[model samples]
Target chain A: MNKTGRPQDLPLSNPRADRVRDVAKLAGRPARLKRGHFLVEGPQAVREALKLHQERLAGGEPGVVTEVFASEACLDRYPEFEDLAEGTNARLATDEVLAAMADTVNPQGIIAVCRFVDVSLDTVLDAGPRLIAVLCQVRDPGNAGTVLRAADSAGADAVVLTASSVDIYNPKAVRSTAGSLFHLPVVLGADAAELAAACRARGIGILAADGYGSLNLDALQDENARRRLTGAGPASAFDLGAPTAWLFGNEAQGLSAGELDLADHRVAVPIYGAAESLNLGTAATVCLYASARSQQEPAHGETTHE
Target chain B: MNKTGRPQDLPLSNPRADRVRDVAKLAGRPARLKRGHFLVEGPQAVREALKLHQERLAGGEPGVVTEVFASEACLDRYPEFEDLAEGTNARLATDEVLAAMADTVNPQGIIAVCRFVDVSLDTVLDAGPRLIAVLCQVRDPGNAGTVLRAADSAGADAVVLTASSVDIYNPKAVRSTAGSLFHLPVVLGADAAELAAACRARGIGILAADGYGSLNLDALQDENARRRLTGAGPASAFDLGAPTAWLFGNEAQGLSAGELDLADHRVAVPIYGAAESLNLGTAATVCLYASARSQQEPAHGETTHE
Candidate 1:
């Protein structure tokens, strides 16, 4: 390959280089917090970080993405990355250097350094959010990331991770989010009780999703059906479309009795099969989409019932 | 710890033992194909294998579980495993031995050797199936496993993996299934075209889920909505509740044009938000649950609309 302009920078051949070591350390929670930055690995995540970074810089806000490192092949495959690197410290590195910096065995030939972009709970609520997903004490990184992606796909306004929840910056969690971390506001380390109180004050009814909840999601849908048949609008019943905050619990042990009590209505995704229950991520997706469908569809139409 | 009964047997301390080597080799495709056996790692998988083994034996079928190995801690944690070992060969091994024979860094102290449990496509279809999940060229083990779990949760009759799909017995996929592998019939390595034909011959409608499909899932729900409002009952339209087979495609390249042509209807899950699309597993879960809710609910009540 012919060497040109920016690609002529010496390839980072040393895995022990200080820059590589610093990026590698960001994989750990302590390192990420201490440095106030996190590593975004793989092509998808790096692309998303750059896209969001450009948006923030355009809005005159501090850029979330500080640096972009790519191999010649990666930059060639995604020429847009070069443009995305315009305002950032973009560097050309050997594949080995990128691997060393990433927590995964393979970093897909690109990685980016991004500052922590978690918004404050006050900021998330001040936007007057209607649909939100609050993960309470969810410890699995993969589950956390999947919920974030699902929430983002469901067009949720925000996602709040309670203090006891898994760190959203965990590389596994970030990888699982599939770049959704950059799509919406994600609040970390918030107190669950205080957040519940805040949501209630803002008129966002909290619905706790648990296996043993008093409200069955099916019954809620039935209520929607009856109301629609009776000529009531989507706003008349407490179905999935209501402005609400869904609180999902831990993987093994679900929301506690006290946690369940914090919600306006405790809801369970109805299980019709022999399988005991849906996993946290799957259940949360179902709940969020239910609400999304309710809120998006017009009253007395093909999509109104559920 | 008291070394009594079978616990007194010497631990298989050698990681390089011939048995350990053979078990470890099963993780690869060639070894599994040649030996007609695969490794089921972790407690959840092993427990499911043994439980299903017991059920098969009771049903007069050959036992699928051939052998089981566990650490003293794992055996003690689940005393039921002791009872489950009645007809199968069980051995106590050191944790290192278990780890060496397993695929993951930690196998949670137990692993089971199981015969390939895939049934013939005809066998799956002959049972008059109402619901099925078909994966076409899906290469990710985790996504494959998750779809199996979701399908099981939704009470599907069976799951069919196209010839190009990932192996269901992959240890990572088995782990992701969370024991759902034993809960339902998983038919692997079937020709996609033939599977579609079999589904058609059985009067099962195939709904292909794609991002750019002509039919919207919400519109399918709307079809159900119009039917219910008009008192046509749940059986009147191309709604989610109809007896159908849901075909999902590869993670990266979705169903090809040729593949999509095989389905009765190409359906797209509505994207209500800005996110590009839902991940394969999450989208499959939503599709499966939609059908489940449709099939399981009474024809005239609260769950009727969805």
Candidate 2:
């Protein structure tokens, strides 16, 4: 915005403009990889991208967003974007232009071009995270994003996607995150075996979410509760309150034998009804929240000690 | 060959036949409503539909599946389908014919036209269910289906979709259920207030899932656990272990004030991370699973009796 806090220029009316094409190309992998940038569309995601960008700029780090295109109505509806997009190259654009530049038919009249936000796995692990979610070969963009959003809601310290997983920067994936993509640290394209080893060395137990696993997730959590509340139960097979990383598998095949082998234990979210099995997102939400609740619940240490 | 249990005759090759068009029309609401039927696509869903049909027929009840269409390859791949489809009006079709009759790009070689399976709210409550999930104005078909599948996984006795909620028979919704639709009783087009009152009359407590509610789901679950383990705690705001119905709202706007007013208590699935709120399916899954676990936990009331 200019000194008056108005959009910088006349609305970009040409949908075929070189700038519009450049922005749209970020929707695909080739351009994104070449330019090291991805698209963040709609008000929620754009708002989050701008917030993170502003936060980084304030912290003396390089900003996350490079450019933002928003229609005047979007600016009017969400005035916070003005301040959030202050340091970025924010521009006024027509709906036609915005639509052309967005992967989603409805970009909610706003879009942001952002630098890839994934951090190195080492950076995430270095923070001593107590809760992490690892996705193994999850191919659906929407499923990946849903799991990430669930992870964020569960207060997971980080989210890691293995090499064969769908790109979280894929526009649908970003949209599916509902803006949680910017809320937590995400590590993409890491090797599952290496991740498991590093986590193991750090004492973060890896629990594979499998349908036919020997250990029941609810039973484990109940055991944890029994220990926390009564202090009379035998030592549980697994302490859910301890540091942990949960391994989630693909939408179809689930964790492979090799992938399951890397985990300390294979745990199944018990299906109470005949569901065959839980969807990846549902299973992940249940498992992550179980760990979150166990780790975060208030300790009645007196009962445990006696 | 008929006695030998082979696919009856030549495969359907004409994609433009009247039968094909009639079957394909089920993808739209008008067609489904007119015929009082809906499409169940994909192997898993078709298998579930066939199983339910077989079970119903065995019980001298009207079968759920009205007609079945599959490619010979699909039947060959899933041999159990032969027995499952034994009494149904099963027909073999070419891939082209199957695609023409399917809503999905790839129906995975099978689709079934099944009668609308939703029952009355009174029927559901008459079962004396221990747990139920009620969807209020949930618009997205996938979201509705995901919640239903999650509810099924949680072993919820039934699911109720209030009037104006997305039609669960929408192909996307049916596909999202991933066979869980056949596993549980569902009530659609339910009046929220009336349903709430019915549940109340049945001694079932209503809990609305709200992001800003006063009651925290985790806290309530913890209190239940403490009481279950220690047999001593203040009387909880609500007993999660009791017969209960959870109200889930729309994807974007949560429960309206009027809708929230229908519940005995409004509970927030704790947002332990920076997420603005949990997605409807995630929140529903967490809430329903919490109730499921509390209700399903083995009773150890020796401490409570004292």
Best by lDDT: 2
Q: Tens digit of lDDT per residue, candidate 2, span B1-306?
A: 243334688988999999999999999999999999999999999999988998998899999998889888887788778888887788899999999999999999998999999999888888899999999999999999999999999999999999999999999999999999999999999999999889999899999999999999998988887777777776789988899999999889999999999999999999889888888888899999999998887463343323
Per-residue CA lDDT of candidate 1, range A1-306, in tens? 443324557778788999889999999999998999998998888888888999989999889987778898898787777777786887889998998898999998998999998999999999998799999999999999999999998899999999889999999999999999999999999888899999888888899998888777866765565465445434433756668899999998989777888998888887765566788889999899888877776553544344
- State the DockQ of every prediction: 0.47, 0.72
Candidate 2: residue A81 lDDT (0-100): 79
TM-score of each: 0.90, 0.97
Candidate 2 structure lDDT? 0.91
Worst 10 residues of 1 chain B by lDDT: B297-306
Models, CA RMSD each: 3.6, 1.8
Candidate 1 residue-wise lDDT, B151-186, digit = tens: 998899999999879998888888888888888888
Error of 2 at B276 (Å): 0.7
| lDDT of model 2 at position A86 | 81
Please tell me which predicted candidate would have the highest DockQ against the true structure.
2
